[model samples]
Target: MSNPAQPDHYSGLLQGIGQRLHSARQQAAQTVNTLLVQTYWHIGQHIVEFEQGGNEKADYGSGLLDRLSKDLTALHGKGFSRSNVFYMRKLYLSFQNSETLSHKLSWSHYFEILKADDPLEISFYTRQAALENWSVRELKRQMKSLLFHRLALSKDKQGVLQLASQGHELQQPEDLLKEPFVLEFLNIPQSHVLTETQLEQKLIDHLQQFILELGKGFAFIARQYRMSIGGKHFYADLLFYHRILKCFVVIDLKRGAIDHQDIGQMNLYLNYFAKEENVEGDNQPVGIILGAYKDHFLVEYATASITNNILLAKYLLYLPDKDVLRRQLEKLLLAEQWDEPLAESDSNE
Candidate 1:
């Protein structure tokens, strides 16, 4: 006998049990995080109170915390060490006011930020981490290399504030550029040499990670898309539709450094898509040249006079060392800042 009804009944019961378990797990995690955040808030409040109460007697606060930590550890168990109490004091000092506190960020996130001495940079990274929901590892990497400072150097005071308050918004073309796109998801070593086909295949296989690396609003359209015109044929490396930009993005991958010819090719592709392939409501197509390396001087000259929708950018197969990339971005920004003056000087000569 098949016993069809019995199997269906059991499967339904199991599914209900699984759903209940998932709900319980989620509730438990939420409760734990809430309690932890509440405790940190109280800790901050107490520290402020102690300091305001004129406890200026030499090292009185320190002695009090040392004794309290021992008693709390004995009573409650681990996680109340003296060093952690110091972190609580620093955390309170870092965020002096409650208005700036975020309910979404966890205590662990603040603890990590408290390790940094720079208050401005700490605040910047904290807000960014909360808004982006970055993992602890991502926070560590960004903070260690001073990602905020690098970006701030590229913009004026107002622009810096905008970047901190609201992250990279892709309303315009320049906003889509990040000097180095972190590709740790690829799991490839920085030193490893890979062919263009190999890189393309890896990106396709791990398409989800690739989308994240490309930043927000990128949705994959096709890979190795074919195109034919009159007597010639060409294949685009990858095609993506950016939801926010409301445009088709065509990407061409080059294994080596980019040249002027590459820019011309991408421009041709953009023109074809803009004139022939775009749907009724679609915006003009944008083409990007993704090469392993690029000469910014040559690229600027190559793309400067052109009005078509095309951008040239470098892509890395692996996550670059943060310090090196930070230096590179800083140099690039400085050069861009002096470009107008340099051009004028050259014209006068």
Candidate 2:
């Protein structure tokens, strides 16, 4: 009779073989994608050179792309539309160095990146998309949300450049914070009077998108995470573990402007988590008091004495105006007024 362990050993061998096959197939797909992207880049180069050989501006207006689309579609079929050809040309112009292209991103990702109006915006989205492993849909959403503008609003010129070059880096607690965190995905109208419970429920119902808004390294732990002390109960609105920071993040949602009491409660939650829930090797817990509005002076004074990793931010039900945010960022960079607070009124109710 066959040994009883033979089946187990055979199963392990099969598992290993399956994993290898999966890895090889992924590699093959990635290689194919990279080759196609490079091919399109070369095609763009050819188009540019052909245009240069004639009157450049004249050829552009003379429907070069329109004629090229018909010929290329007839020969190759599909994916050679005038708009796509225009994008391919733009792709080459945007990224002259083929080596700079990330293998992690597909042509679809680059197509979205090329739509950006500014070079810095393009670079920022490109780096962020690759590093965050964002899908085409996610990339589009982030672009619409004006994520680059949100992050750059507090940074100086050099800091803004760093964002474009390196994407959003999560080195410390503050790095993970964004003011007026966009909640458009919740489908909640701003005019509707929202309760804390309703807001929390909506966030839980759309946890995936919420985490995406939360940025990288956040893993949802619980909603209404409970803390019991002296037989009294306290519940955090949402609790997430940050893999990068090695800490628990407590989020407290407020329907309106946050008060001193809200800050103190969040502080209490941080202290309790640090002393009670945090295991060995875990860093200090972080607390974020998210609300519709904030009293800037109150926030500054209330948290002045508190020595904890706490962040206060606003949440909006609608997408922020890109022009307004962009203008604000420009002023911030030029002034290098890091201490100057951004106007919280930009979030439309």
Clashes of 1: 0
| Backbone collisions counted per model | 0, 0
Residues 86-183, model 1: lDDT tens digits = 77767667767755766666777777777776565677777778776777776776665455654554365566667766655568765656554455
Clashing pairs in 1: none
Q: Each model's TM-score, in the order given? A: 0.75, 0.89
Q: Candidate 2, 178: how far from true, in Å? A: 1.3
Task: State in Å the error of residue 46, model 1.
Answer: 2.6
User: lDDT by residue for model 2 over 8-91, one digit each (tens)?
Assistant: 898998999999999999999999889989999999888887878884532333578888889999999999888788878888
In candidate 2, stretches whose alpha carbon ends up further than 4 angstroms from where it belongs are: 1-17, 58-62, 337-349
lDDT of 2 at 14: 92
